[model samples]
Target: MIINFSNLMFITLNIMSTLYMISANCWINCFLAMEINLFFFIPMIFSPNLFNMEMIMKYFIIQVTSSIMILLCILYYKNFIFNLILIILMNFCLLMKLGSVPFHYWYIEISNIISWKMFFMLSTWQKLGPMMILLYNFNEYIMIFSIIMNSTIGMLGGLNQISLKKIMSFSSINHLSWIIASSMISEIMMMIYIFTYTMMMFFIMMKFEQMNLINIFQLFFFKKKMMIMISFFIYFMSLGGLPPLMGFIPKWLTINKLMENKFILVSVILIMSSLINLYYYFKIVYYMNLNKNYKINFFIEYNFKFSFYLFNYLIMTNLSYLLIYMFYY
Candidate 1:
């Protein structure tokens, strides 16, 4: 309901820049598109709130620094004595941009102050352009190191967080490892994983926003609402990559692909870290399911909202179609 023309324009331009990066043949074009996308996105996160201004500043500083380094590396690529150093530097910059481990401090801090809508954008769309650029000339050794670090730190970071935003921030980092790994295997596989992740996060964020939830404890207030409970269970479980759910497909495929390519150690590490991710996800769902004796004046009617049915329908249909396609062919 609070739509702004300027915000819409920024969103469009940001998306266009992302597309440009994806199709760009050269590193210069990709870097330019990335900077444009970052600038466009910055305006959308600005607000009158003082705390949010700090968040904006931190995000801007980190992204600009990374951009500067990447640009420097690109400009000096021809003169550099070793191509390996350039690849490592560029890969590190992209990893920093993606908010993977070792560069994730800024990411978690910024997410804490942003709105849920911005959090969705930060976790999803903002990552696409940099990730696409990363595919151009990634270093295998650096990527493997990132895989190990991200899988470990991403899980450990979320273990004790009471804030929902922080938990999801860590979750995004954990998922980023899978995404980076998938990109190594196949671009198409990465796209499918990203698509599924975006959809699951979209629905979960919608539900959280609708209920005005900010932390794990807030879930106690909605325990009486069956529809909310059920929806939370489905979406969170899917996000955890549980089998028979839509989220598991991309993960299963990624593991299979990794094993196929003989990345057995990385595959095993990812699986172990995923189980830990699932642990925290299940902790959240458990919090929602816990019975509470508190009473409130307002009552949620037995009938559910339109969103509940719509989300469930989409999940079931997508899972069925995916199953048939993956197995049939």
Candidate 2:
């Protein structure tokens, strides 16, 4: 139950990085903040026996390469034609940092090797700075391509994966498409997407951590807990952007705005890819429900405090659309 010094340091540095990002007045400042954020997170991955050195090395190399590319873009911003090229390169670097589509290989590889806490940060918080930067200076055509690639790749990537972490990585990529699309429409919509996505992922990661569940097959261990299974069904369905759930609100708003702006084709693509992602979500729930006849006593009981928290979280997630409507309208 004791806290480690590295954990404490990571928290402090993460906060500082976020604050710097929020208050950044120039590209240089934002880049430095991102560097600090990456440096701090590297230490969090440093477990003596459990950590994967190869994954750490790959992450470091990719991120550092992107950082250097960003710096070069900033340095050579004066020329007219070269500036245009640099801007495109900058967007690529940011997209790479966000682990979107074609640049997501490192992310999937690293996610499989990291601890759940680090995975939570990587999947959620680590996206904030780069995404914010992308929103500010994004190219319209590039963004459209990114949206298509992210949605298509994310949906296809998770189809054959048994590892829960790999599945979640693809889910993150899928959600990244929606988030990027939202940003193209409105800042408020983008913020809403980020918040909902973070909350849903946090809850899912917490449940997985508690159960020590890392593979889709391991979900069978909790087959007796109907309440937990139902909660997970709702959670994953919401994440897949099903209607009347917390996750759909941002997507609904985004599609409305896109259509208003005459982006009918993009909206259709988004819908189709989301349906593909939902197929996998339902697959996970089907697997969980399949072993219901097994009467093994492997079900773990939650403590009173966690049980109360889980109940509230379930209720809140299920009814979250009402809250969103009340706030927005």
Candidate 3:
């Protein structure tokens, strides 16, 4: 109860700091808010001591370096160009915060060290605070850089991961490109994609937890059909954007927008990347279908009955919301 309460408090404080950054006219206050946000997360991540001390040390170094960069950038942000520099620093800070590429080693290590619950929070909720902070400082160039680098590296790097958590972390990164790209087209599309991605990820994470499944190939032993269904939910079609599914919508819109502007190479790259990226997701599918015998690999006892239902409801509701908004709005 105490830990949960403290977690709640930290989350609440971080959120308030983000809104303070958005509403604060004073630059000092804004940077302070960001600093508070950064510090709060470090404490939360380190509080358990479950992670490798080395990982904690590395995380601290990277975070402090990025924080200083943001501080210096804030000092120089007196005009548009300086603001651009600040934006770069701030986005880099988020890139650091979320463990996106060029600074992605932390993610690979952290997932191995931390608990899955912590991983889920770090992967999803921690990203939200940064997204809120970033929205106030949007520029097209920043979005483009974020999309291209995040998409290209995130997808390609994720291809080599065997840990389900690391794969999901990179999966989150891949969707980050789509989300950032969505901002370029329409707010509705962005919201829809994020909502769907979050919901689906919640299901995927919880399902993996319940099954005591850690790595990808472990799915091969689950005789339960429900597990297969869950695997399909994650792989075959997500919330309207992959291909021949509802999840394909945002990707289509994004590609079309880029093409209209004659971004032929970029479009081709994204398409090619997606084709390459689908391999791992399909691998899980193949493994789940290969073996008929169930051999439980997890020692930790888990009951996923409630989580499965909750996620089903969320996926359906969010998908419905996406359809309605796209059709009517």
Candidate 4:
């Protein structure tokens, strides 16, 4: 156990060094970073929780395959083809990491088994380190592939999902695509995308915890129709990229930047994909309002519709202003 823990610690340090190297934008250094990120998850497979063996095995194989690709790309420095192949392979692994289909098998399984907080870390931070390396090394082409992968899978897979965890996983995938989209354009879009995604996700997971609601289907039991409707509308609308919400900020920037860069086809595809996403988002809205099957017993001690009162005004105000700032920005 000590040996395994030490090895994991060492691999994590290697990953950190690689991230720093890539952030400097040196090509060879970036390749090293990719290789390190690919290999660092190996020891995670040896974890004793012993719950997700199959998923861990799959993740291990995928990471090793991706790492081998990166190493080969490094060996043949002159061949851009290897570099491209390496990028695509690593991108494929990241898609799998982020739980986007058609590589989404491990996503649901591991998430189902892991603690929510660990699941949150896996979905958010673990992906970020590798993603930062990708952006630093090969932003444009890699980002295009990421955007297509994320938008296509997220919107289509998330349709009609009732499981809250699964839905949040797909939502994470979509927002990740948004981050990839922003990365292609400029540094500022990337920054804003990261910040907004973090804040949005913080609210989502917390709200999920507060409601003690297991699935999106149970969201109707949240009690206060007045506030539930409002909060749910804000959340879904933000997800839908509706006006003045914080969610629109990234999309607004993405579309403008893409048009400016003359990537019209990809831009159009993404916009239409957002529409596909909205189709499902509205379904939640429909159920939240029109569902007469739910018992509306109000919780006297804690209202899940709004957050704790100390944060109540502050959270609501900022959320509403996402709409305002969407227009303003």
Which model scores highest in TM-score?
A: 1
Runs off by more than 4 Å, candidate 1: 292-313, 316-318, 321-329
Kindly indicate the candidate among 3 and 4 with the higher TM-score.
3
RMSD of each: 3.2, 3.2, 5.2, 5.7
- TM-score of the candidate numbered 2? 0.91
Model 1: ten consecutive residues of lowest lDDT:
316-325
Expressed as tens digits, the lDDT of each residue in 134-213 for candidate 2 is 87787899999999999999989999999999999998998999999999987777888898898888878888888888
**What local lDDT does model 3 show for residue 63?**
68
Off by over 4 Å in 3: 1-3, 18-27, 47-51, 79-91, 138-142, 186-188, 227-236, 243-246, 294-319, 322-324, 327-329
For model 1, the local distance difference test gives: 0.86
Query: Which pairs in model 4 have colliding backbones?
Result: 244-322, 244-323, 245-322, 245-323
What digit string (tens of lDDT, one per residue) describes model 4 on residues 186-277? 66677676766666566656666667656766756656445556566676667677766667767877888889999887788788878887
Global lDDT of each model?
0.86, 0.84, 0.66, 0.65
- C-alpha TM-scores of all predictions: 0.92, 0.91, 0.78, 0.72
Ranking by lDDT: 1, 2, 3, 4
Cα error, residue 249 of model 4, in Å, equals 1.4
lDDT of 1 by residue, 180-287 (tens): 999998778888888888988998887777777898888766646555566777788888888777788888889998999999999999999899999999899888
- Model 3's TM-score against the true structure: 0.78
Q: After superposition, how far is residue 118 of candidate 2 from its true place, in Å?
A: 1.2
Which candidate, 1 or 2, has the higher lDDT?
1
